[model samples]
Target: MTGPEHLSGTDRVAEVIKDIDADIIINIQGDEPMIDPAIVNQLIDTFEDGYVEMATVASTVIDNFDYVNPNSVKVMIDGNGFASAFRRETKDFEIGGYYRHVGMYGYRKEILLQFTKLDQTKNEATFNLEQLRAWTMEFQ
Candidate 1:
């Protein structure tokens, strides 16, 4: 299915989910060994209202260097606490309220299936963030 092997994480996810059956799926990164159970519970609770399609956790950034570091993924949250944007670069106005995006994600089963089929957007490719592909498609 590929000459150059450009399957991104989302693409691989699409491939893996073909056989799974579930109502809700939570994706927690393998590297996050100390992920809080409370955060996972909070993300799961968001689905109980039945309005959220996709959700992720973001932590308050305590260090200035992490806020400006390209390795840290910063998220802009809306007035309602939903994510507005995800980026490696921080905006000028975000210095005070910036939240660093945690790698975990919760997705409705159908939405997760649909996400795998989406084409990678330019912003996603540039940032190397598969989540942006979902954001670009307005999945939430």
Candidate 2:
């Protein structure tokens, strides 16, 4: 894989994944120094199905107002467990109901490769979300 130019740590990570051979790659946020081994195991378990292109965990949101804050991005999953969309605010919200998107992500090798080649979209650039670039190409 070629070296990244002016890429953030997350983008550089996608570049490194291009040359790996593993079926699934788990990206753990380094900032969470106190993460439990059990949580790591659970993350790996979530991707047991070979077809899962990507997977991540989410904890129930205790605050409804936080769900509308742009700093606190929200994610919704499809029936198949794939991420359907991510945004700051979502409609049809009941009080005390939300799911905070965890920073961890598991991805298949091919999907990771494809992710590195996609162009950034308007929403992606505007929101400064690298994940949107991959999902724009249906890679996520």
Candidate 3:
């Protein structure tokens, strides 16, 4: 199940499981060698509500440098706990609620496939944040 080189981690998982039957799919970035198991549990717990189709985690940015670094993606979560936006620039920190985007996600199988089928959105291409594509789809 090979995907395009430009496909993001979430997109790749969708492609990989196109043939497999599954209720849920979890995507943990390969770069995160020390991902905590508890985070996975938390993601699973989010699904217990039964209405969640997609989810991810975020933590407060402890280092100012990391917060400002364009390499460390920042996330803006809505009051409902769904991600509202993602950005790599620091200029918007003044808007306040900024958190380091954890490079992990859990998706309902159908939602994952739908995510991959959606076209890249303007913000997504601008920030190189694939999750933004799902954001545009109103998955939040």
Query: How well does candidate 2 score on lDDT at residue 77?
Result: 67
Question: Which lDDT tens digits does candidate 1 get at residues 18-132?
Answer: 6788777788876677898998999899899788998889998547887779988888889988788887888787776678888888888888878876677899888898888
Which is the leading candidate under TM-score? 3
Clashes of each: 0, 0, 0
Report lDDT per candidate.
Answer: 0.79, 0.67, 0.81
Q: After superposition, how far is residue 134 of candidate 3 from its true place, in Å?
A: 0.7
The estimated TM-scores of all candidates read: 0.88, 0.74, 0.90
How would you encode candidate 3's per-residue C-alpha lDDT over 89-110 as one tens digit per residue? 7665344678888888999999
Q: Model 2, 1-140: lDDT tens per residue? A: 54747234456777777666688788876655666778778888876766667666665643666676777667766687666777766676532445677677777767766665666688787876666765677764
Worst lDDT 10-window in candidate 1:
1-10
In model 2, the worst 10-residue window by lDDT is 1-10
* Ordered list by lDDT, greatest first: 3, 1, 2
RMSD of each: 2.6, 3.3, 1.8
Q: Which residue pairs overlap in candidate 2's backbone?
A: none
CA deviation > 4 Å runs, candidate 2: 1-8, 18-21, 90-97
